[model samples]
Target: MSIKILTILTLLVPTLSAFSQEKMVSVNGVNYHVLTTSLEQRKPSQPVLVFENGMGMGLGNWNTITDSLANDAPVFLYDRQGVEKSEMVYQQPTPQKIAANLKLLLKELKIEPPYILVGHSMGGIYVRAFAGYYPNDIAGLVFVDPADFTETKADWNQIFRTIGVSEKQIDEMLIKRLYTPLKVDSSRYAAWSEGQVLTDLRKTDFAELSSLPIPQVPILFFVGGKLEVPMERRSKDYDHERFFEVKNSSNMLRWRRFIHASSKGGALIYLSNSGHFVHRDDAAIVIGNIRMMLKAMEK
Candidate 1:
């Protein structure tokens, strides 16, 4: 696949509303586009299911997962400050800032918590930060192929070595996949760069949350077992599939560490048929596991 394809797939802006209603809500002098399902199915005591999208992704990314979940509970999806209909921010947005903004947005909308926060990829970092900052507001957490801050160049190189890829080749592949620029509009580039900055700063960014006591909420971590990368993101220079398989092996240890830190009922589920976008690749599994968690919580 070409860079054009990669650009389209990676930074998909929301042009369509996938939920029952789409509206803009102001929080801290900025407008954020939000999509919500009907509230009729939700009870006063029930926890709201809130979803956070991956880097450069819009609320629409959760369309399939939320559609199935709408009947079970109220689902909330929103674009961050720089994506979709949301206003752009002048300052760098860290997970902590995003979490704080989300809290204000929820409060302004009168969506009272106990919330089940489901985050995919980079969004996982934000959800984790939210739970840390406001432990009382969250009931459970779901991380779908989350971004691992502890991942290092040495860890990646070790995984690539399993596929017989030399250090130089591994470095090259990493640069190409990570640092290469996509041919897109300046605005999209700006939005993507902001997210990239936060990812790069992940190790030191959530320091306050890291210092605080870990939230003991029920955590569900989904680690994708399949090696699934878009053709555009893959190179002909190496065995990308084999490399991804090895990388997934390395990620399992990290995912396990995350799940183990949560409450007794937390689970680390491995889906062999899924990829990084586990919710998209295997929506049934994502929906089923989340439904089970919700049911258990309800009991």
Candidate 2:
């Protein structure tokens, strides 16, 4: 195991990389890449936890949080068909279709009802629709710095521009920083179809969540109180306007407030030390809050 030999092997087999334990689950001849683990350690009555990933994110982005909690429940993760390991078929999938597909996936796998739905960013949008469409099946909800229409591309882009990023640079950044880590082919992100699916779904999902009656289930919305923008990048591109005027950006503070009103007990937590990826930024807080919500449900 000499250094030279190791270096030679690495160069010769650039594609040689370790992969996680996973499998494909098919529903109606459509195959989906599913990564399931941790049920063995689950308590008999514990509700299954299903993760709905954010736009341009895959199961890998959740490793930091899921790895620790996987043993605590039957945790399920999958690609939204065509985004990553899952084969792509749907084009600009609607919110209802997304919700239906997830329900089907769960049904075929026998994951059953009373699920704890955890969603981040735009993933929260789909989770909202799922709860609305199948309120009886959902037990609880955990939203990590969830996104909604209150904050628009204009708001986000202005922030980027303030940080001195050109439109082209922003596109590249989204592909590299947001999508690439998920194993998404960069071209798909750049394409019209790939971007439109989430964009249209966001509008549809947001409307669905807004129009629905308040949920009776336990719901917890976590907001990253203060956004932490990259200082080096911000400084280099500083125009002195503002780096992240995102204090009022999250749905917790605005449009999605009804979620907190879902129940007198529904809660909203602002994590001052965290950012968009709240679970990754402060898993302890997220886990602690979830445990607290579960405990509350008993009463």
User: Who wins the TM-score comparison?
Assistant: 1
lDDT of 2 by residue, 225-280 (tens): 66565555454533432544543443445635655465645677878778788888
Give candidate 1's TM-score: 0.80
Candidate 1 minimal-lDDT segment of 10 residues:
1-10
Q: 1-299, model 1: which lDDT tens digit per residue?
A: 11110111122223232236566777666778877775545687798999988887888888778888876788888898878878787665676788888988787767899999999988887887788889889888998988764466567668778878787888886676557765544567536655665545543534555665556778888988876568898867678888777777787786677667766558888888887899988899889999998898877
Clashes of 2: 1
Best by lDDT: 1
The lDDT per prediction is 0.75, 0.66
